[model samples]
Target chain A: MRRILPWLTPLVLGALFLASGQQEVIIKVMGGAQKPALAVPDFRGGGDAAQHTGVFNETLYTDLDESGLFTMVAKSMFPLAVPQRPEDFRAPLPPPPRRKDAQPQRQGPWLTDWSAPPANASHLAFGYLAVQNEQLVLFGWLFDVTQQDVSNAQLFGKRYFGPLSADGARKVAHEFASDIIVQFGGAPLTASKIYFISDRTGFKEVWSMNPDGSEQKQLTNYRSICTTPAVSADGTRLAFTTYARVNPMIFIHSLETGRRLPFYNQVASMNATPAFTPDGRQVLYASTASGYAQIYIANADGSGVRRLSNVRAIEVEPKVSPKGGEVVFVSGRSGPQQIYKMNLDGANVERLTTGEGEASNPAWHPSGEVIAFAWTRGFEPGNWNLFLMDVASRRVDQLTHGAGRNENPSWAPDGRHLAFSSNRSGSSQIWTMLADGTKLRRLTSQGRNEKPVWGK
Target chain B: MLTKKYVAALLLSFAILFAAGCKKKAPAPPPPPPPPPAEAPAPKPNPPMITLFAAEPGTIERGQSSTLKWAVEGADDITIEPGIGRVSANGSRQVFPSSTTTYTLIARGPGGEARRTATVNVTAPPPPPPPPAPKATFEERLAREVQDAFFDYDKSNIRDDARATLTRNADALKAIFRDFPDRSVSVEGHCDERGSAEYNLGLGDRRATSAKEFLVQLGVPADKLRTISYGKERPQCTESNESCWQRNRRAHFAPGQ
Candidate 1:
């Protein structure tokens, strides 16, 4: 929808009739559902040698990677191989390691000297920028470590940005890196935005910024006590609990439109932290329907809803798959919180992880092959780290070896990595890592980045 | 002869235009109207009033007709909520609340309209009071209920049995959204408990929200529906199978002060 209203161009009064000719007679089709693509016919006017780059590219990638979808290896990490041959477009990736110990390193390494593959990293990603005359071009590729280069280029995406200025350059770069996974990965990437509750500004509105952590825009910049922001499947909407009038209510907000629609509010109980359906048709959340915490669902426009689950346990932190076909939620049903999954219609019940210590905020890897969930280590009581498990093999793999209560794992669109808030460095900063949990890179270095969501 | 007359008329108009163009044009001046109201009566305070009134049903029920009515003092241009669509300048709209759904009204002009939401709970003859409404097996029931909400997703709002259960549940409701002199309630969100655990957790939260809303329209306060999502966090069906997931998709209300 371009959505970016044109702010340029003069309103020449004499040109009123001219502008009228350009005034788009947009027949707003089916509300927010399916908007017809501009239907840009395949006019193969091949992109000139000019590279298109904007200020938001990097900010988008940082946001996307921070979403935990891509295991982004910074341009600094590349072997100077990608950019050197941007014109050729075919460069061989590094060879795969024989084994953790088989590589030409100290054999029989001690258990602690070698933590398992970082977050059980099984994949690697590389991104680079190329400036071709008038435009800027960014390139990224993901490879399966085990299959080596045998893995097809999972990501060969690029973003063509508009004009750029000195100040907008950095933002545009990050937007590119963040969006590569979305365009090429074919899923929602959450890293491009920020969700923060700033009581520091005297108001507790939810504020978001570009992934470069710039362009700080305030979603609710009021004293309304807004917290726990849950981004919808597409990243255009935010579902969070707020105490606007002293009563806490769950609000569905349009980030682009700044329209706040209130539902299930003014109740004796409070509704907060909504997880939207995969199709963005409904929102799943917890409420005190029978007086105890139970799960519920409702349409995206907020109508025709019903209950799907009932239990006496305190359940929360639900992450829905992109298909809206299944759901995984946190439940203290067994004395401690555990993760569970079920159908979209709330059927075919099954428990995936159990006996683990307080497993909360489970994120589905973009490929849907594995799930990355925040869990407390078995031996360590307070140390929380992100864990991954194969959906089919039922094998659990740990991602974080460092302590610091890394929580709220949000998956990126590519399903190769995730982003989470780690206090490891003394403050809350958003960090990204490979799905296997290797190559950890800190993205957000300032002001409490919590609840990271990959945006589309 | 006609050509000469036309030419003469054209020449006369041309001459008039030439004379008008030659005349001196004055620079716009500020000799305008009344001095800015010396005191601006403090923007008369906003008054509270029914900004909308009308029936939800555009037509009448077998015995009932939907009526939407609203009024906002000191204003023109009033409208009833679209019985199902858009309303015009009137405090009245038509609807059949019990037999049809889509009952939501809003009156707008200058002041914001007060909101009133109600789904039509049309009875094919006041269903036999649910005849004990014996609790169906958890899985069978959850599937049925989920299927109910699913229809509205394709078309309209709650209908038939879904409305029956909602209405019964509504009958036992109280204000859930009041803050003070009020206590908070927590709703456990759940899904059909199928497919991937991650998927179901999200489904449950949505299912939970669906039930909470029906409760609200039944009279519970907006403040009372404390909702949290359990994307398939826990399940009543401990057994791992399709039957179990079916039982899991539901919003279980645990009412507390």
Candidate 2:
């Protein structure tokens, strides 16, 4: 086996290059409790394409590394030999069964063994890039190197064609990483955007950026305080609260036309935190139209308003479940603020959080099995931290430590990550983290960003 | 004739006697006039006297100005109630009252004290039926009548102080509804900067709703009041202290459409 190593490397590398261009290839391998180590090698391309390929490869590595589910193996530990083509190497089949009673089985060739000890990487991802007609053509492939069957070892492969630009490289990389994540039975979050409030322009306004904190752009310029932004499922409309008038009123902004229309124009009354129902046909918000802050539901256009909660206590920060069966909100009906869930019609209200301290800003996860909210211990003096509660079990897990005040937890479409605002960096800004409070990354650094809502 | 001759001598005597008696009766007519009474000593005058107190143009419309003029004799200090403090012993002040008001003037001195009152009858045109009371606009109500009810940190239940404020607010709302039957009241809930905006909104909402509910129980029509949670968005104080946060975590009342 040691003598065959030099020849085996080239053959395996060649096979990966040949397999890269194929579209929609999927393979699976047995997984374990520990994070699988992954190897991301540089793509095979030359000239201007080489630079683009480097960018793509680096981005893919970063994405996977930031996911907190994979351990990247460095290239320095790779084998000395390199294969440039598919014909340069070939794998050997396993030996036949020794017992005569054993049925004859088909055997598939496996790639060179790199899944053990020092360079123990269970999977490998590599691809090729080409510049053709001023367009970038990218080929990406993921292999389960731990698998013995070569045919089954190919996890996934995808080809992307886009403009030959840096942004194009990022797009291709993100798409490929999304494919890889999906192959691992995890939801892909790369395509989503985050909507949050920023005071960068001297006034708090609604703004949005990619999940990776790229392409940040202001969405509303009311020149006043705009906050609590909620994006529609289709990403065409944004619902937010603005103080352009005497009182804070809900407004719906059309992303396509860049026009904003007042959703609730009742003078001297507050209407805020407009969350769209799963179907986007209705909106659930906190309104003082009844002379108290209670959950109210209205048509998406702000018509046909009706009060939803009648607890006579303060009910606000309402979020409709993804399934549209119930609404979770922060209520003070039982004394200190606590998260409560009620049916769409406000029936069968049940408290979701208890014990010392206050719980608020309840956001139902898209998966509909858990809720994320902000909690602070009753006797604590610092800021609120994030917490997740299983809806069924009522078990709670703290997501953020007391690293500045972390609150306003909004779940990404994938349900595995959340975007929240924290003042840990000296000022309140938007930050993202995994569901279990890992992989904390800052998303905004400018003036007092907050109330981040992840877009679908 | 012989009898008359004989009687003449007697008559002459009788006539002489009657003339004498008539002469004596004339002197008795001047009987003594009534005697003059004895002279009495002069009495002493009282001191610290508010000799004159008057309100010029006493009959004026509501909110119209009236001048309270007063004159005091031998007084060290003079003051009036319902807002005016110590003033000159003899002075006048321009006053504006929303309704008919009676101003009392008190003058104090070594000799003693004196009191006088001048009534300014606010004489606006006859109010319409149902006794058209002075109606306060929404803004005016918010500034004048509606009280801000505050709460403890992280708590939304009405505090004792908050209850006092809500009681006054409820009374004001009742009067407002009486005068402007169609108008409604809105309670705005607010929070301090200590908590998250999302959570604060809920907290503020609870505060506002708690206040409104108290008002309802106090006879402010439930339908006449509404509630909104501004959360921490509209803070009354920006400082990072308990005082500021206490002010921020309050329910402010205002007139609504």
Top-lDDT candidate index: 2
Taking chain B only, the TM-score of every model is 0.34, 0.47
State model 1's lDDT.
Answer: 0.53
DockQ for every prediction shown: 0.02, 0.23
Flag regions of model 2 displaced more than 4 Å.
A1-36, A68-71, A74-77, A82-110, A147-152, A156-158, A261-268, A378-382, B1-151, B154-189, B202-229, B236-240, B250-257
10 residues in a row with least lDDT, candidate 1 chain A: A36-45
**Each model's C-alpha lDDT?**
0.53, 0.78
Cα error, candidate 2, residue B247 (Å):
4.8
Please give the range of 10 consecutive residues that has the lowest summed lDDT in model 2 chain A: A21-30
DockQ of 2: 0.23
Error of 2 at A77 (Å): 4.3
Clash totals, every prediction: 183, 11
**At residue A232, what lDDT does model 1 achieve?**
70
